[model samples]
Target chain A: MVLKDILSIIFISLGAFFMFIGSLGLIRLPDFYSRAHATGKVDTLAIILVIFGLVIYEGFSVNSAKLIIIITFVALTNPTATNALARAAYRFRLRPWFKKDKSKKIKKKMNWEIEIVLFICLLIAAFVSLYVKNLLTAVITLSVFSFFTALIYIAMGAIDVGFTEAVVGAGVTGVLLIITIYRTSRRSSD
Target chain B: MHMFFIYVSVILSVIIFIPLYRVVTGPTIYDRVLCSGSIATSSMVLILMVGVIFNRIDMFIDIAMAYSCLNFIGVIVFAKYLGTLGSRRKNGT
Candidate 1:
């Protein structure tokens, strides 16, 4: 294969791998705080890598410089935003999830079951989006579908969009939602 | 190379949906504010991306800059409201 093809494949694969890890973090982390940690740090890092791949593919173009600038801003802001959310949560007195010992096996088991169901549902939603319905439906289910479509843009050399997706999807959305959950209910004290 | 631009734009818009979920399901006013900020941040990125996708980064850069300023103002407004609410509740006590 040509060098461009080789690079594209490698970068895409790397991005996918990072995304997978980030998703796993979403599922496996015990609670909102840890989930924020996983989503914000690992996901942000993965997307930066994906954008870097796109930047390389777009080399020497003006778009490439813009891509780099977006990347820099994201790298700077993503973590700060997440930190701000976490601080907000802490200031509001949200508690981290901590399971009691096996002496409370029944309650522990219940929590585990709840977590498993959440994971399964999220997974199913992700899987189904791969072959779902019409464009309108797809638009509705868009977030559930993979970011693989983004690779197409990179292959086409649209670095700016790739950077935007990484920041908005992984960075801001995750932090805002986590903080919102804390701010919204009695659960903020927990 | 052109296809690259398409992919980037698609991805940028695609991810903007995630925050919309928070905006829709928000349990409180502050949540909505936070989600709106996320949306604004994403839109700013989208504006910049649009410029790049269309090969007009200069124009989009201006838009993104303006949007960022607006977003900052919005966040500050919300935060100020939050502060006042907290102080009012305290004063009543």
Candidate 2:
């Protein structure tokens, strides 16, 4: 009996601590996702611990069965509900908050004139690629857009990024595009 | 032992304020929903502690089960309701 009491006390104390921490996280964490992370996962664990501790205290009885049932039900549902709420928030376009460097000043460097010309061309390429009637032309224009993006990276002095963009965007993706385009016979329904 | 349970229940009650604070200040509907979930969980724990304190585990355990049922159903239904909300808004109300 003493052992049982000691065990139950230990379990319940631990559970109360966890519950406090979970609630603290709900308030202290910034933004929706972090708050969700704190409440959803931690709260579930705390409830489980508390209930199981209750069961331990109750011994093998009808009350223990009821306690077990609550634990099972909570364990199953809490995380599921948390995930669903998160998905709904995401679908509703809830923007997550993050810290930004407000004091950081924006500075212009390098040949910005060339950047302006490239940016305009990029916009034009993107537009043309989307609205063009021919599939092949769309693919080709997309490749051109990719090529221009690579040039922008070069202008930004990211040489390694520029190389990656050229290879993946202009080389591999261009080939894959042509292959996918030619592979299909049903060009258009309209 | 009863004193221990009493102290534990008091702490649980105090802990609930943190989640309640989030429910008030949370920007999105889901954040508020999440906070409510957290509070319910803590309440369930508190219910168990109360059961231990009163030495009537049978009666209080049922109440906790009922609270759990309500919490799960409310949250799930709310999530389902909000799922298509974005698409409806995009479709111009």
Report per-candidate DockQ: 0.09, 0.21
Q: Write the per-residue lDDT of candidate 2 for residues B21-41, one digit (tens) a residue.
A: 454445566776677667656
lDDT of 2 by residue, A1-190 (tens): 4998899888888888888788777766767888787877888888888777778888999989978888888889888889998988888888888895333222222232445555665776688678866554555456556655765664455545755665677556756665664455544621
How far residue B7's Cα lies from its native spot in candidate 1, in Å, is: 4.6
DockQ-based CAPRI category assigned to the predicted complex of candidate 2: incorrect
Give per-model TM-scores: 0.48, 0.66
- Candidate 1 TM-score to native: 0.48
Which portions of model 1 show Cα errors greater than 4 Å? Answer: A1-32, A61-63, A98-190, B4-8, B26-49, B61-93
Q: Model 2, A188: alpha-carbon shift in Å?
A: 43
Error of 2 at A122 (Å): 58
Best model number under DockQ:
2
